[model samples]
Target: MIHEDSPHRSATPGWLAVRLPVHALWLSLAVLAWFAIAAFAPRFGLLDWRAGLGFMVMTAGPLLLGLAVLVAALALALSLRSRPRGPWWKAALALAIPVIIGASLLQLRATAARVPPIHDVATDVVDPPQFSASTMALRDAAGANPLSPYNVPLGQLPAWQGRVEGAQAIQTHADLIGQHYGRLQPIPTGGRDPAQVYDAIVAAMADIGLRDIRRDPDAGIVEGVARTLAFGFRDDVVVRVRDGRIDLRSASRVGVSDLGYNAARLERLSRAIERRLATP
Candidate 1:
């Protein structure tokens, strides 16, 4: 039963180890750890969500990739050894799950790196419509990131500044932002008068699930906060009806990089208003 020179004895156990996920357990555990920290960590409120997500993106993300590589190597060897068996292909595919998920997370970071690291995006960058005082008050309140719509000089925020390139104090001027995201171009009234457009703006905000909706008739400013569905991150939105143009601004209440969410919000609202305004 024991011959030191026997190839079958040595090869069979090694093949079983690789083909059965003995080394691949590292990949599974790392993937599970990332999922727990990135997703459920916010729900538990164990730490600031930015910290939690950042750790997942910046730290665990790389670790996951490393683990995936190891799994891939071991799994590849096992698949070669097991190919003659009936279902060896399944083991190889199973080992690839972690690699695919880890690659996706890294891809997100790569895409974000190519763009400027700024959260505030407005349709009208130059003289972007300011948030109403009431909306500012809500944003400054607890559970929201305290930010000045105009005076939030970049580089001043320690957490946010750390995410930007070169780590210098960034200038928040509209021109700087316009260099990247030019004015979204005011949604034309499309023959609708100021009153109709203003109402449509408010309706669009509500339709998009904004909370605590308020409007100032004289100022023609509609103010509300849009909360993300899953984690409830709030973003302040201000729509101004002036000069026959509907100018909009959407800024996240927390986190330095919004991942283009604020821009997407403004775009979504503009499209919704266009449809509603066209409806008689």
Candidate 2:
């Protein structure tokens, strides 16, 4: 029988002392590998963006990270008292993995909370420029988020606002646009020919990294799809030149909240168009 004060005695049980550090090391590596797959698999079309982001990255990632943290903490604590010092470096590395990932996830959550939960943005919220039939067809086929009506003419706002208890009066998408992004108004053509403005818009779309551009000069509309750099998620953008003003509308093909991507895209495209028009 081994005595409590025997020279060979260790604070951690023999089986546990060996297993915990090993588990910590492998768990940390698994977290790193899973993160890469979650981020890049969608971009390469290996998986759907929704599945990759919603399930793998946001859900499973956190779960794995939580496990890693728990396991690593146990390992580190036991290692401090183990006669032959446990692999302290392995526990430290495992702990570091979750810390980094948790920080990034927190930052992303903060950004999402700051923005209104809307995906469509337009320069003219009232009767915003409409997408073409073909463009609408593509969006429909892909199960894109439907464009909210210009205003709540369907009488949704009043119905939502009428309740006395537990009622949160919320504005329609159009009203949200006006409240949050009132500065995004139409760009004046300055008496420039509509055709000239159309050409400028096309160049601006290209400059802003849109793909598969389709311009209908006769219809006075230009439309393109913007593929995000990270996940290749598509956002449809259309520009209309009418009534001596240029208007833009950007709607994401998926996602309830764009994290303000559509609004930011419109801002970038508008600035690009304005720059081109001012040059000539």
Candidate 3:
């Protein structure tokens, strides 16, 4: 009597069988790779026109190739169904292609997600508090006398308290400019209004064909090219003129270097003030 043998079952492994339907892995990986490129490309110079284009090609090419290989492997596995005796490793290898691709893509995306964006407001057009030619002239002339109304000695003022005074004389001056000139009020005590002063200084410096002026308003210091090789910081120049003498005050967070720059700028500002003060 002839015996009939049982039909052969497909010998694919359980792990591969479970992983076969995970097409999302490849897609995820691809997304990750794109993000990685985006995040780090700038730092590595890969985002440069020529380099970025090349990087894009390289990244996409390998992913597409892997996908193609995956598709081919899957197709081959399916085609081998008829033979039933084909190698088991072939099926596992075919499935792994897409999984590897997905993992790579995910890695790239993770890298991209780690980068932070850059922010800059320096060159933006900011409306600064304005000062009237007459008022500024008066203040400058008063500041010049060393015994005038605006001059105050640092010794008589309170010690540096580190907080920006909102109602100090310097702040009051800034407030006056805003009220009279329609510009935003800057912090009075700190070097809050350096940008405003910067514009004026730049224009003044430009008149003499000097271009490399640097101003640090936070420190109340302004330096670089002007009529002369001028360098001044805050804290060195602000003097309250009183009783025919110069009174230096530690009203704000102005430092010694800052004062030096302020002194220089104040001298120029004083000249402008004098011109206006002499008028009528």
Candidate 4:
């Protein structure tokens, strides 16, 4: 005769006892450590953005996340039959970190898919604002994406967002940019000449957080570099205020895809310029 409080029987059934094993927390902690190294390495200058973010985070993060998730799931399954709860809630909490990171990575991948693979973004695509000699020297010395619209060497290219080789990559990038970002055009100067708006343009550039801003009033060019907050990735920006219009170009110093970052930055700068021009 079995009793209701029999020692052989579990007070909590398998369904209610379904909890992750405490040991699984170690897997989650490992993933958290990997995430920290991957994310902060570039910002701290411990590693280059290409190596830290592109290779470590984007390339290796998913594998670790998958392993963590699998271990947590398996641990939970095995612990379901165990009588002791065994700090299972802490294990469940730990599991959330990898899942969240995996979701964020997926979102980033989706954003990359939506945008063109080109790192260079220009308001004037027909005749994109050329970088100054010094700026070109800076970029070239650092092995940046070529200022030329296309004809990038295959070997020099970073891991592109899209699977393309040689000229096809650039062509596809151009076509996609034209399709999705045709609205990125020169900002009107409201009947003001380049001379009138030159100072305001410089002010706008500074207002929008551009650093090392160099202005050539005679040439009507205001150039600066924008460093990203997370990875410290540098994108060169050259603003051409000419012919009663302001055209801007933002090009990443590395990588095959800016993940729509340059375009978004240009949009913010464009708005800043417009606001400055509107102000008395």
| Regions more than 4 Å wrong, model 4 | 1-7, 10-22, 75-84, 150-162, 165-174, 193-196
Local distance difference test, candidate 4: 0.77
Q: Any idea what lDDT model 2 has?
A: 0.82
Between candidates 1 and 2, the lDDT winner? 2
* Model 2: residues with Cα > 4 Å off, grouped in runs: 1-25, 75-90, 153-169
**Error at 118, model 3, angstroms:** 6.3
Residue 251, candidate 4: alpha-carbon lDDT: 90
In TM-score terms, which candidate is top?
A: 4
| Residue-level lDDT tens digits of model 3 in 117-166 | 10000110132122233424543553421211222322233332232333
Task: Give candidate 1's error at residue 185 in angstroms.
Answer: 0.9
Clashes of 1: 0
Model 2, residue 236: distance off in Å is 0.4
TM-score of 3: 0.23
Which scores better on lDDT, 2 or 3? 2
Model 4, C-alpha of 116: deviation from truth (Å): 1.3
Task: Give the per-residue lDDT digits (tens) of candidate 4, residues 1-280.
Answer: 9885565566445443454455568778878887787777787888777777867787887788888888777666555545654456655666787899889888988998777767888877667787899999999898877764434432345555346656545464445556768878899888885666887788888998999999987777999999888777789999997777889999999877688999999999999988888888
* For every candidate, C-alpha RMSD to the true structure in Å: 4.5, 4.4, 21.1, 4.1
**1 or 3: which has the higher TM-score?**
1
Where's the lowest-lDDT run of ten residues in candidate 4? 148-157
lDDT of 2 by residue, 45-64 (tens): 99888787889888888898
Each candidate structure's TM-score, on Cα atoms with residue i matched to residue i, is 0.76, 0.81, 0.23, 0.83
